[model samples]
Target: MFKHLKSDLPSSIVVFFVALPLCLGIALASGAPLFSGLIAGIVGGIVVGALSGSSLGVSGPAAGLSAIVLVAISSLGGYENLLVAVVLGGVIQLLFGVLKAGIIGYYFPSSVIKGMLTGIGIIIILKQIPHFFGYDADPVGDLAFAQVDGRNTFTEIARVFDGISLGATLIAIIGMAILVLWEAVLGNKGKVFKLVQGPLVAVVLGILYFVFTQDSETWGISKEHLVKVPVPDDFNSFIGQFTFPNFKVIGEPQIWITAFTIALVASLETLLCVEATDKLDPKKRTTPTNRELFAQGAGNIISGMIGGLPVTQVIVRSSANIQSGGQTKMSAIIHGFLLLISVILIPNVLNLIPLSVLAAVLLLVGYKLAKPATFKRMWDLGWKQFLPFIITIVGIVFTDLLIGISLGLAVGIVVILIKNYQNSHFLHIRKEEKTGQEVVKMTLAEEVSFINKGAILKELNKLGDDSFLEIDVRKTRYLDHDIIEILDDFGYKANDKNIDVKIISERGIIENPKDYEMFFNQEKKENLKVTR
Candidate 1:
């Protein structure tokens, strides 16, 4: 993992900066103590990275599961009880790995996966807007459609007008400008520029800004806008901050249910992120899904025991890892240790960073996820692909993450069935070379199912007035009952259109066609049916 030490160091720094705010924000959203987020981050980085086969993927406390964690904690008695569930959840995930359930991640359609990433990106941007404007009523990293504070992304923005802090806004603007300049200009200058990441620079500048404006009461920058790292008076008191899980809760049924929920959701989210990170890898590395699940399970178990929120492979942090030039597991490991050391040794220094500055960093991350080109590319793929993609995007935008994905999956499945139905048979209009006449030929394959009804109807509609149509079933060994009924109905309709119908089969053409049902029954009796 440390094979590329020099190259991995800079990337680790970038991921560290990106993860710091997210860890805190997600913890706040989950209603868990803030330090739990850091614990998860530390465990995810060191434990998960050590066990995982993935090089660039970064695991941490996810905003996606915050809502679930919050509800589970309330229903299951308390945060410590929830920790018992989390530990059990980790065990379940390990079982999932043993059962090889990780393969389920491979079945998601590419369009839907892309849509999910884009949707998450949009949500991140929308959620960060309030923080960018110095609005701290909502948590910095909440992603759910409705926040615990009884406001949503849009409503929060609307409220900003009534409660604007001039100093916070100005500091936010300056922080954003510095971040933009570092990324857009300075970042490309040379080796030195590349060594110093934009996020780290922005954070440093934010602290300096706060220092200069600390005594300026006229600037409107309140204490609320600044970072709020909990400070313990002494070393012994600081050690008391860590919470331990109540082992007695292990016997409860609700704890088991919560455990299963966390395990299932966290594993699924991690698998999806693993797939995404693999796609973004410059070296095009393929991650082993089972190994990733095992790693996540291990990380979660350790995190839960120590009073941390559930950990999972998070795409937001993994993307930052890749974008920042992370090349090995060493980078992820380093970042994890960084989280541990910083919270322990430099809690006071961390407290100086303004929330608005961190918000600016996330705003950029969000913009990159939902770039304009993403929509354009999806549109160019045509309706079959585009419909589900757009539906997923819209659903995610209006609803929440899980619901939007479910809607898209449903639409995508329907489209697949429709296409399979259409392609099940062959419809063609042929011209005889010898006789200069056009003849319509409809050929049913070796087997036909109910899904073929639409194709049959479409071909029937294409017949011209007073034209001869040939329905060939010579190659068909079995035909579905529903399809036979449709043909009978089409026969009746053919007479009205002045179209002459001819049926060709191994049994020959039927004059009255009264025995059509008999032919179907005979095929079924012969045990002739087509498998998918």
Candidate 2:
């Protein structure tokens, strides 16, 4: 892990910059103490990073869980009570890991996964537009279409036009230019460029811009558009920030229910991020999902025991880490330490940095994820793959992350069922036999399930009178019981239609076989196992 120290260190700084505002914004959105988000970010990066098998993934307090946390905090009567649920959620995640449930992530189709990445990219760009112009009404972490501020994702964009800050917009434009120039021209030119990332420079300049223009009436970047880190006045006050869980309410049924909900949601988000991060990784390294679950469980448990919100693998930070050239988990761990140290030491200086500069950094990240080329590539893959991909992006943009993924998965399943129904069997009409009748052959697929029943039955019912029908199972290894019953019924009706039927299988051929069930039963009894 240390082999990539130079790369990981700079990457960690970019991730740190990406993560700082998110920690505060998500905490503000969740109605929890702003310090709690920092704690979760710290625990997620340091604790989870230390334990997780993921090399590129960065864990933190997620924007996705803010609503859940908000409701749970109020419903449970206090933040302390909600912490109990978070701890229990971690335990449940551990149980899930022990059961090897991480395999669930693999079941999602590539189309859905790619859609998720692109959807998030579009969302990032959409959500940050307002902030780019200094309209900071919505929290930076809110990803859902309907926001807590009563204004939705799109309305917020329109709202920004009414409240654009000259100072914020100007600095954002300059910061964006710096980022583009550094990435395209100077990023690889010298070791110094790599050591000091473009984002770090943009943020420093933003702080300086804010400091120098504090007295200006027209060009001043206001405090509302700046990064907000909880500023503790003294060491004793900093210690007072940590809140312990109230385990006294552990007996309540609602607490248990909340625990299960958090566990399920958090695990799912982590698994999905794992998949997305691996795809984004240039190395294409696969993380151990079960171990990731266990690591996340441990992180959440520790985070909740203190004053932290729940933690999960976050794609935004992970993508930042990868895009900035992170090669190992050390980058994540270092970011956590940066969060911890910054809050303890220079939070005042942190609060001086402008949000628009950070927005510029995310804009670049968003463009990388949702580039126009990706859309064309997916479109070229054909409808079978493209439908789900497009649907996932739309759903995510209009709804939330999980809902979009669910919609994509549903479409993918429908496509599979359609394919299965159509490809169950192949029908061939050979030249007429010497008996002056047509010969029809139906070859079953390698595996036929109940889904293929209708197709097989339709073909069987279409047999012409005085025709010779050949049922071929030579390549089939498994046939469903429904299909067997259909073939058995067809065998009994063949005489009425004056159709001659012959069944061919690995087991010897049968001529005009009327007792199809018995023949298959005998085959099963002898352990041939060709038909169900």
Local distance difference test scores for all models: 0.82, 0.93
lDDT of each residue in 133-203, candidate 1, tens digit only = 77788777577777666777788888887877777777778877877887789877888878777778878
TM-score of 2: 0.98
Q: How many backbone clashes does candidate 2 have?
A: 0
Which residue pairs collide, candidate 1?
A: none
Query: Which candidate comes out best when scored by TM-score?
Result: 2
True lDDT of residue 72, candidate 1: 90
How displaced is residue 290 in candidate 1, in Å? Answer: 1.6
Off by over 4 Å in 1: 430-440, 443-450, 457-532
Q: List where candidate 2 sits over 4 angstroms from the true fold.
A: 523-528
TM-scores of the candidates in the order shown: 0.86, 0.98
Per-residue lDDT over 13-50 for candidate 2, one digit per residue giving the tens place of the 0 to 100 score = 99999999999989999999999999999999999999
> How far off is residue 68 in model 1, in Å?
1.3
lDDT of 2: 0.93
